[model samples]
Target: MSTIEKAMEQLNRSPGNAESVKPKLQTDELSTKVKIATAYSEKIEDKEVSVSHKKQKTLFIDDARLKSLGMISLNASMSERLVRDEFRVIKQKLLKNAFGVNRQETLANNLVMVSSANPNEGKTFISINLALSIASEQDKTVLLIDADVLSPSIDECLDLGEQAGLIDYLSGEIDDVGDIIYPTSVPDLRIMPAGRAHHMSYELLSSDRMLALMQELANRYSDRIIVLDCPPLLGVVETVTLSNLIGQAVIVVEQNKTKISDVKQAVALLNSDMNIGFIVNKAVHKAGYGYGYGYGYGYGYGSKGKNK
Candidate 1:
């Protein structure tokens, strides 16, 4: 058996305990560490569990969640074209955006909205990729939920066919949320697909089941930073329902692409007291600072957005 296989078998034997899953990082094999994970960043901490390399609080994903045969959701594959030497720089910037907040108290308040004034605004790419970036960073756990029930992009991102996601839990069809959660190839990162498609996505999100599921996740995975990939606030009522679910929501706008009227309307709908942020995706800038390829971090309300 290969080393990875052996590790898997050990992991399966004692799945609940945090110690079983962490395999030692062989510093002898590689001088520079490729990744650094911690239980603190992800919000899971287990003291008894001690392992070499970066220590991460383990998760109890459904058996099928991590399975290979039917695994629908897959992470973006690393390409040879990427400059390996500078990859860490990109990851660092993403860490700042996903987790960075106004104050220590606001860190947990940094929620994101995966929306645009219209469809095809590159919201899904930003949502999923940002989630992945945070997960790949050491010790942080990111829960990517497909709140875009009207039209889900995670299905394509993970390439998983038909069924299993939030809709199931919301509609009273799925008994266990664990059954629907899929562990991506990336560590410290997991995804909950859009579940089965439903015509009334807005109704589903407002149901008792939906609220229960969110509460359960928040209570159990207190350390995790949950990112809900919601629908476009302009037309979808699902985004409004999600507003109550998350403390903060963000809208993704394509610069010079989305109509100003649409953005204004969406902002009004999401108005009043809730934490809202925007990511100016697909916008051209004169280059403020070369922080690699990903977008830089900006927390809370800013002049760059319509809020001011």
Candidate 2:
């Protein structure tokens, strides 16, 4: 069975019943080729540009990344417009709130782990896009990790080339996590895919090695922020484990789809107090978000420019 299929089987057996494990999950960086594939579309043919640049790789990534990457698509010009009109407005609010809440220092060190109460909550999409946005900012380095060992999303997102990563390192199949890390087209951004799922991979990360790895990562990238895209929290042990590792988390609640009951239960399951805010995902157009033009979030990268 493929890793995804195997993960499904494991989910059935585990059923997110284990008590919250200490240490947690969060997630991206990717190659230019990989990023274009993952961030753009699942279908290569969807891109009008010449795929002939197999060796061209990524020329460069935008300076600023985004939260809802899959929300809009356009030629480079259109994308830039989208970022200016849509992203900039909300981000200013995020920064102001961070400073106001006395979390000025915490937001800098935050290893935000994004997940939902269930699947298709746009957690994976949001997590990946957010990492891209962070990396774009000057002096800020961002690492996006596919910590969802049970069911990896980065590979699918980026059309990955690596055969192993987080799972291999945690299971002793690999020693150096560096071997698995891939740099994305975006400047200062890197990715660590949850290696192919093995037996009890959720349990595997709880081990001391995994804990050490996370600590090592935090120390190595003390200046950079890390984001984890994890399995849902309500019934997943790994998500709980991730919450414990990082003092902060962001629960992605998809509008309309997620039930309030599950959200309450998942929060109860998590023992961490780090959740800074609730990232409302897949939300419909609500007022107060001053996007002069309405963004129909039919919901669902990179370095070199300024906010001007």
Backbone atom clashes (below 3 Å) for every candidate: 15, 31
Off by over 4 Å in 1: 1-111, 283-300, 303-308
Residues 1-308 of candidate 1: C-alpha lDDT, one tens digit per residue = 42222322332342222222221111111111111123222323321211133332233333233222112123322431122222233234334443455323323333445676688765675676567555655677888888888788776655656658788777767766676676655677777788777777778876655655654554455457677887777767756655544545555655447665676677676534444444444322323211122222211232112234
Model 2 whole-model lDDT (C-alpha atoms): 0.51
Q: Listing every candidate in turn, what is its Cα RMSD in Å to the true structure after a full C-alpha superposition?
A: 17.0, 16.7
lDDT tens digits by residue: candidate 2, 45-100? 23221112122233233322222233322233553354333333333333332223
TM-score of each: 0.60, 0.63
* Candidate 1 minimal-lDDT segment of 10 residues: 27-36
